[model samples]
Target: MTYADVFRAEWGQVVATLIRMIGDWELAEECTQEACAAALERWPRDGVPDKPGAWLTTTARNRAIDWLRREAVGAAKLQEVAAMTDEPPPAYDVPDDRLRLMFTCCHPALAMEARVALTLRTLAGLSTAEIARAFLVGETTMSKRLTRAKQKIQYAGIPYRVPPAHLLPERTPAVLAVLYLLFNEGYSDVSRSTLSQEGIRLARLLVELMPEEPEAAGLLALMLFHDSRRETRLSPDGVLITLDEQDRTRWNCELITEAEELLDRTLQRHMPGPYQVQAAIAACHAIARTAADTDWPQIAALYGQLPQTPVVALNRAVALGMADGPGVGLALVDQLATGSLAGYHLLPAARADFLRRLNRRTEAVAAYTEAIELATTDADRKYLQKRLVQVSVQS
Candidate 1:
């Protein structure tokens, strides 16, 4: 594999391993970057190593040891590192270090946005620019947020280890939420495929670590269900394709079946959370052989069980529109337009669709114009622009 691929795969594990050994986030990150730089310089000449992760970890650990010895502050920590370096790497069925780092980054003490940003940065190895673009924020803002989060972790004495069984109930939700957001950000944009895959990988790790946590399984199932449609979500020309317009034959049936089985297993646990409910809604779409066969009423009912965030409410309005009528959906969309969702692009987009369905071409044109203005990504903007043209023509 190319050194770039190795760096992407191993950066998190190497940093996590060093952090666990040295108990310093900044130092571990610094040393890991140094190791990556060194690899970039040397690997092309010497050829890729068989065990790149092990090589990177050893290099980073040595750098940490050198720093510790020069500082002479933590002899005990240095000795521990030396001892670890002397021993061969263990062949484990799972790596707990990365999991521990994920939980640490998603600690409840951090702000929700900070938790999501930090997890994407540290655990998923995403650059600040990539993350900023994903969330529609400035790179400087994301950099500052990450810096403050790391400082909080250091100063507030947030433990780096995973929470105990008793504490899992409290801590797991934040972690799951961060992962879910990460997945959604990646899933929404075609250019961010790596981020989506990383999110899925982490979700799978969470399930493996906490087998009894049905929510973890539910989150994984939810992502898988969405991922099953990834190939058909966009056209070959990179234009966005709405769900109803996507070709069902291109959908990954294997992933859909797996997600269905997983959601079924999680539901049998008898505890339904937001992810499980969302997964069920996704399953409602996945199981349908054709767009007309989709169970919109069931999907709308499932949305009712979810907390009424503006986004959920917007989606519920769409499902209600499909199940009931465009007038019903338009009323709900109008109500949201006056609320916190006023500036949201999808709010206007939904309004435009409902208006179009009712043949209120003038209102649809206005709403589509607003949606085009608010849309973030080029694909979304292009799609909205296309819809705007159609509605304007009708008007």
Candidate 2:
């Protein structure tokens, strides 16, 4: 493979392994960058090796040894390097190292915003601008958040290894949140690039890295259920189509089946964690042959049990509307309006939907206009603006 292709495929593995070896996330990232730079210069001439990942790993290892020899010159670390001379060095294939990195990047010890910005930057290769767009924040603010998160890690000495299995259950929810955030960052059209494929890739990687973890399985299932409907979310004219308006024939049956099987297996574990419940909610939609056929009542029930994350409650309210009536959904949306979600776009959007259903055209148009003002993406703005137009014409 070309150097570019090789680096893209193997960069995460090399960086993850280096972080494990060096016990410093920032320095390991630097060493990997330096190694990739060296490979670019040398590989075209020396020719790419058959095992490029191993080649890159060895190059980075040697670079780290050289740095430590000059700076640290310690006894134990020096002995560790010397021991590495006789062997090709073990494959960087430690299980769950990536998961460990995810937790570190999104440690709750860090600010919630910082956790998200750092995870996307370090794990998914997302830029500050891209992350900012995801949350409707300025790029400068996102950059600061990322920088602060890294500093916190450096100062707090967050370990680069996964916690012991006995501690896994306590920590698993945080790990799942990281993966979910990662998938969401990519699943939506927050950037010029379509991250849907990338989201699927990262989800698969996390599940592969932590095969025995039920939360990881739930993560994969959650992503699969959403991904199955990606194509159906857009019209040929590039308009955003609501799920109830989407054509079920466009959904990916294979992905749906895979996610269903995962949901079944996840249920056997029966810890009923947040991700497991979210996946079950998605499964309700996946099993339906049509939007009207969806089990909205079951979805509403799952959402009721979902964690107290505001987004979860907001989503549950939408399902409640579909399952019950606009009154129930509107009450929930109205309740959140005075709470933490006062300025959030989805609240207004949900309010608009309920108003429209009740034939309150003026209020619906105003709510849609507020949603449009709050929207970040051009796609979302256009969607809300169009809804306003429709309501105005009807009025």
Candidate 3:
């Protein structure tokens, strides 16, 4: 990897380790930024270090210490360092600390929005503006949320350590949910800035750091299974392409194989968690040679057995429509439309597609128009517009 790439890759580790040592999330974040600035200035002539992660950490630590010394107010921080002066610095190689950082950022004491903003800023390397745009909010709002989150972390004395194994069952699911939210934020056009690439990258990181965690593995597999279709999910003109209409030949076979293997292994562990079940459903699609070959019945059955989340149910309904008919999918979509998802554009978007399939052009056109009106992002709006056009022309 190039130096820039290396810096980006090590950014989370550097920030995470500093947060552990400094016990101040905002200060650590600032120190990490300062360290990167210093690296940019010096690395060209000093050359990359043998262990860049350690180099960044030590450099950030020294910078923080120097600032504290100058201020003459960090007696406690200084004393803590002095007490540990003889000991070798803790290794940043364990890598699980980054995941721990995620848990810390998403701690329930903070508001959910704050957790998301802070997680994106600290762990995911997203800028405040980038995060604001993802959430369809103004930058100032996102900035305040992040600031409050960091302040809360400091005031609440939130420890930067992974929860214990006994506590894992209860807490780890929240961590998985955050990552899942992160993945979807990137996967969907609504929030994605990078080509679902960020989501895939983050999911891969989770699996790498927590290889034994079945949910992490399952989530990674699920992302890959769906991401393999990214190239064909949109047309050249950026219109949304339904799964059955997508060119299966363009799917990434290698990713499909890997996802299948991961799903198989996860299934054998005998842990029938939400992610594994979802991965199993995606696996049915991966195994299909052609759209016609997709075992819609099996997918529908898996959806029935899967845990009840609105998004999962929504997806299952879509699959059922494809597997069974628009009547089944429309029924589910209608229920969603009547309730919490009233403002959600995808509900209408999905309804439009199913309506079009059912030759209900007038209703399809109206649904597509509603989706376009509710769309938050330019890409999604454009996609909905195109759908509206197609249905209008058909009518």
Number of the top-ranking candidate, with lDDT as the measure: 1
Candidate number that wins on lDDT, 1 or 2: 1
lDDT, candidate 2, equals 0.74
Models ranked on TM-score: 1, 2, 3
lDDT of 3 by residue, 1-395 (tens): 56666666677777776676778777777888888888888889999888887778777887778777887857898776434332333444234555656765666677677766777677767678767755656779889888888888888888776655455445556567667666666666633535256566666776775678888889888988988887887767766676777888999999998998888887788676778888888888878888889998888888888776666678788888887799989988888766546666788989998999999999999999998987866768877887788889989
C-alpha lDDT values of all predictions:
0.83, 0.74, 0.75
Ranking by lDDT: 1, 3, 2
Off by over 4 Å in 2: 1-90, 93-116, 127-145, 156-172, 190-194
Clash tally for model 3: 0
Question: What's the CA error at residue 322 for candidate 2, in Å?
Answer: 1.8
Q: What TM-score does candidate 3 reach?
A: 0.72
Report the C-alpha displacement of residue 102, candidate 1, in angstroms: 1.8
Pairs with backbone N, CA or C atoms under 3 Å apart (clashes), candidate 3 = none
Worst 10 residues of 2 by lDDT: 85-94
Candidate 1, residues 1-395: lDDT per residue as tens digits?
45676787788778877777777888989999999998888888998888888888888888888899899967788899887652434544335555556665667788877887887777677789867765556779889988888888888877776655566656677788778877877787666677689888888888887788888889999999999999898877778999899999999999898888888998987679999999999999998888999999999999999998878988999999999999999998888877767656888999999999999999899988999897767889889999999988878
Q: Note each model's CA RMSD in angstroms.
A: 4.0, 5.4, 5.3
